[model samples]
Structure formats: structure tokens, C-alpha cells
Target: MADSVAVEDPKFTLQEVLDTFKSCLSENKEVFLEHYVAGWLGLVRFMNSLGSVFSFIAKDAVNKIQILINHLNGENGAHYVTVQSMVKYELDNQLVDLTKRGSFPESGCRTLLRLHRALRWLELFLERLRTSTEESKTSVMCSEAYNESLSQHHAWIIRKAAGTAFWALPGRATFFDVMNVGTPEQVVAMLGDALPLISEVYQVTEDLYVQNNILDLP
Candidate 1:
């Protein structure tokens, strides 16, 4: 099911990767970074669904996630042991290389930060979508999420691209339909189940970045 959805349909593939993350949370402490973070390839294809503008942002995020996944899957060295450990290891070793590979937002910290930041948007938007009654709008939810999460520090182009996506969002029915989930009620229930895991992952990453002072780089 996942394999078919992922191929022949790029957007569905990305969402599938995100769904994989949700599935992995069942592993908790046993979660392996290689599989956890290696899903970026699918996500990049998924973002490509909206349009070209998001391609750059999605690529950046995918690039960073892949780096972590590689280090974890590699041998001959202690890879990032935890989200917290990874942050410290990268920053302390100067692996981040932010501005001119020195200032801020090194590929590592910066890209994860994007996903971290987007989590808040997802929470807000999902919460809204959850309680949404009476002709709710995906565009509004998406826009609200972007404004709250991914917009402030991003370049104008990204902000504009994000905004464009929000506006381009399909209505609720179409949106839910694309999710390939069940009825609205069923979807909401599933979201309730899935969101906390997503939020936990986000919070874990956010705290790591903030404590490491790597939140603003890129």
C-alpha cells in the first residue's frame, strides 16, 4: 500500500513518509535514526506536489535529514546518539558551519530547524482542523500554520511560497479525501492519535536546538 502510494504520486509519497514517522514513534527509545530520518527522500517528492517554489525548501530539509541518517547508519565513529546529543556533537565539533559556513543555520541545524518550526504550524493547524466546524478551510489552516511556524525567519521567497500553498489548498473534503484516510470523524480521531507523537518529536527537536543556541542559524 505504501509503496504504491509513494510512487506514481509524489505528494502521497511525502505524506507517507510523515506517516512513517508516526508509525516509528511506537519504538520510542528504540527509534533508529537511519530509518527515522532517512524518509526525507519521500518528503521531498511530496513537497514537489504543491509546486516548484517549495522544492528548494523541501530539498534543504531533506538534505539535512539525510546527513543525520547517514551518520547514524555509518561505522567507525560514534554517531549522534540522541536528538540532544546530535545537537551538541554537531555544534561542538563545528560541523554546523553556519555562516559562510560560520555564522548560523548550518545545513544540519538549519534544516532540522525547519521541520522543528513546521511542527508548531502543524499543531496549530491540526488543532484548528480538529475543532473546525462549518465550512472549514484548509488554506486558512495551512496559512495560519505557516504564519505561526515557518514564516517569521524565512526568506521572503519561502514565505511567499508557503503563503501560495495555503491559498492553493483544496477544500476540506478534497483535503481529507487526499489523505486516503476514512471519514472526517475517523480522520479526526486518527489525527488525535498521531498528533501528539508528532508534537513530541517536534518538541524534542526544538528544545535541543534552543538549548544548543542553534535555533536561528541558516
Candidate 2:
């Protein structure tokens, strides 16, 4: 999952990413790790298309996605199928470093937690984008979303760097076009459809981590 990594398709629409997110949740509320990774793969591709400025953010996300991908493709992949199952398996086996970062650096629980936090940022950012008007600024929307969500978890240096990148964001119209989802009206409609699913997936994973007391894992 390098920054130069190629996604499944070069021109995938936001709808495809939405479909992946939609599939991430099972009928019984299990969040499929594979689908979750696939959804992130699409988002990372979108981030890469934005510009080199966001490469740092995309790289961190890619690294987390790779960790989950490794666990999903590993020998014990069956136990790592769903978020709930992965949490149970990893904790039961003491495979997670719940305190400070240690041997289990690639633990699925911790890896997903990082991505889970980012997902909140995405949810907030997209909501802002959906409600934005012609005079609205994508940079401001992105900055506001980051502040409300991801900024708290990030270090001072990371936050400063990310804030600078926000100012380099495209205008609202260009942002909507990059989504490849028809017109701005369509993009807003698409967001309306996609946000709830993303929120649900985020909540399920959040609740799982909170219950396991691994929500703040190092």
C-alpha cells in the first residue's frame, strides 16, 4: 500500500467506493475487514489524485490499510474476517499491544482504530462538502472537518502539516468534479446516500473498540 500504489481502477467513481462501504456491513452488524480495506483503497486513490500535498495523509492511511490487508490474507485470516471477530481473536490471543506501542505494531485492532478515526474525518468532510454552496471553500470545509475529528489524535507537527495542505485544496466545484459522480447536485445526493452507511460502519467499529477498551490503544 505505497503512495504510488495503483487502485483497482484508474477512473472509479465515488459510487463504487460507496458500494464497497455499503458491503462492509453485514446483516448482523459485522463489519467485514476486507471490504473495509477495499473502501479505503478507493479513498486513498482519490486522495492521491488530489495532489502530492496530501501524500503524507494518504501514506499513513495506506500503511494502516496494509496492516489489515496482511491480517486478512494471513494464515489466521478466517478469524480476522469481521471487525468483531478480529477484536475477539486478537485480544483473546494477546496479539495486541494495548498499552504503549510494542511488538504487536501491526495489530488489527490498533490498525483499524487509526482508520476508524480517519473515517470520522471523512464522514465530517463529506457532510460539509454536501451542504456547501457556490461561495463555499473546500479548504475551510476540510480544515473544519479535520479539526472537529482527526486533529485531536494527531501530533502538533502532523496537525500543522495537514492544515497547510487544506489550504491547497481545490475549490468546491472542482472538488465535486473529482468525485466523478456527475454534477454537484448528484454528488450531494450521493453523499446523502453514502454517509449513513459510513457512519454505521464507523459506529460499529467504534463500539467494538470501546467495549474491548482498546479505543485508545497506542
Alpha carbon lDDT of each predicted model: 0.62, 0.89
Error of 2 at 111 (Å): 0.6
Model 1 TM-score (2 dp): 0.75
TM-score list, all predictions: 0.75, 0.96
Once superposed on the true structure, which residue ranges of model 1 sit more than 4 Å away at CA?
A: 1-19, 22-32, 38-57, 73-78, 98-100, 103-107
How well is each residue in 1-218 modelled by candidate 2, as lDDT tens digits?
A: 23233544677688899889999999999999889998999998888888899898888888888878878888999998899999999999999998899999999989898999999999999899888899999999999999999899999999999999999999988888888999888899999999999999999888888788998999
> In candidate 2, where is summed lDDT lowest over 10 consecutive residues?
1-10
lDDT of 2: 0.89
TM-score, structure 2 vs. true = 0.96
- By TM-score, the best candidate is 2
